[model samples]
Target: MTKKSTIKVEEVNNQIVDWLKSYAGHSKVNGFVIGISGGIDSAVTSTLCAQTGLQVLCVEMPIHQATSHVTRGREHIEQLKKRFPNVSSVEANLTSVFDTFITTVPNNVDAGKVNLALANTRARLRMTTLYYFASVHGLLVAGTGNKVEDFGVGFYTKYGDGGVDLSPIADLLKSEVFLLGHFLAVPQSILKAAPTDGLFGDDRTDEDQLGASYDELEWAMSQAEIHKSSLDFTGREKVVFEIYTRLNAVNQHKMLPIPVCRIKK
Candidate 1:
């Protein structure tokens, strides 16, 4: 039997719509801008923003993106614009930009961590593109990061996916975001698509990089706060615990604000 969500989907939708409108009104921004990655988090967040009846600029900045990823993004945007006149889209292919940066930034230094660095660079490029549109149109960039990525494991890149004017689903777990996606009637393709960062080149998923499923990671994170019992974790459970703590510790820097050197007067 499928377990029902404790959250009332309908009520949650309405409340979030109201909050989006009220916050945008308070900020006096023209509309909300979001990077539509064809994933549940972005799809759900975009739907919520559209529900507010505000102008939403969903940008698809593909840099060496897979064909399927681009197709999914466009399909969702087509549906979004049909349902909400305020929803609009723009495409920014950052391939040349990234290529230029890669060649110049490293000065051909041959760094071993180039792949990971390039992945984060892709995110930052998208971030720059979103902000460019936001600044030109007087919009605020709405982040699509969810709780597990943002707070649990810090899976987002600093000043990349992590940089945004607002984060609508940052409080919701990955499972909860899927729930909201279903409730929002997000594109079936998006709802069914496997969750990925779209940052890694070889089309690796968050699970591939994280070494555990979101459910296990979430469970492990929840247990991190409680006292551990020797019997609490079995073989796989113990592995999950170790993966969670290791990732949590390494990504601690990503979770917090940049450290500043304190000057003593």
Candidate 2:
């Protein structure tokens, strides 16, 4: 069974719409440019931006992306266009661009490190592509990261998927994002699909990479807030807490602002 959120969906939805509209108004940007990855977070974010009646440009930057990801992304964009006249779409196939970068860069490094770096490179390329569209259209690059990724585990790349002009749903957890997606009528294809970054160009899921389910991670996040320890739990709960603390500690760099050297004044 799906867990329920404590938030009032109707109220939260309206608040996000107002927040996006107000931010765009104050920033004096044309609208928002988002990278739609056929995932729940992006689907919900783009939908919220559309509800503001501002121009929303949904761009697909596929760098060896899985077929399912592309299909669902297209489906969501098409449905969103039908529902909101102000929403539009574009496609930027970065497969060749990714190839060129791979060949140009030195590959004498370790294989595992290279693979991970290349996966992050895919996201960085997409980030560059999104900014390109945003600049051309005088729009802001809207990010799709949720609270779990932005705070809990730091699952996103440093300046890749993590890079954005503004975030509409960074405060919401993954489960909360799913709830908001349902309330916004996000396509079932996305809402039903397992969450994946689609950067590795393989079938592995976010759970496979993170070593835990979002539900488990959410519970861990809550428990961590109370300064709970493994002594407070047992079995899988303890195992999950360990995973959460380990990741949260190691990824603090991504979660915090970059440090600068202090100088005598």
Candidate 3:
């Protein structure tokens, strides 16, 4: 696999920043609200929104299981505030909310399903908070999904992390996000930190669930894209076939809206 040195760092950063500014203006959102999980994706999102001169609110929501993550999240937010003095910070403890809801559910469900449901609930709660603040503060919920997560695997929770007014990095690969971070001069600590969802027990990293590295996934996606455009299916056919097959099979839901019918006029 190719290493990080192959990509043009400066060009990606400039393009991303320019696109972010243009989208914010076009959307006419008064500002942006971003959930900062002490992870690179959210950190990058918050930084770019703040740099765009948008009124940014960095929210830290921690359940009992996520206390340490919250502390790290706050530190990153502080770093962002130092760079962009206009940013604001807020804390909302979600422990009680999660506890109450989980306790109400029966324990007979599969452990994996129950865990996923709980994690998804936490994500939706964060979105609810973002929308509530946005409504009162007249801001848009800024999304933090990178292309590798959002497109290649459909890794986001619908109506949860997926509930965004506008996504600035929707087209960026995971590798590109890091390059942009370097350009923004984001703290080395945050840049090097392992990526996590912070929904399960502590130290639960995203890569643990994906079963593959971002570099491999991205290369697969590129090959799949080329195959779609040309339909040759010649060299590298096996790899390209596997990539598209997995993406289509796993991300079927992303291709469809919540199933509903429009009343015929």
Top model number, lDDT: 2
lDDT by residue for model 1 (1-265), tens? 1123377778878888898999999999988999988788889999999999888999999998888888899999999999999999999999999999977875454564787889899999999999999999999999998887988889999999999998888888888888888887888888888888888766788789899988887787678788355256778888888887887789999888889999999
**Which predicted model would earn the best TM-score?**
2
lDDT tens digits, residue span 1-265, model 2: 1234698888999999999999999999989999999999999999999999999999999988889999999999999999999999999999999999999999899999999999999999999999999999999999999998999999999899999999999999899999899999999999999999998899999999999999999888888998657788788988888898999999999999999999999
For model 3, what is the alpha-carbon lDDT of residue 75? 80
| Candidates 1 and 3, the one with greater lDDT | 1
From the highest lDDT down, the ranking of the candidates is 2, 1, 3
lDDT, each prediction:
0.87, 0.93, 0.78
lDDT of 2 at 169: 96
Q: Kindly give the stretch of ten consecutive residues in candidate 2 with the minimal lDDT sum.
A: 1-10
Per-model TM-score, in order, reads 0.94, 0.97, 0.86
Q: Give residue 191's error in model 3 in angstroms.
A: 1.3
* Residue 47's lDDT in candidate 2: 97
RMSD of 1: 2.2
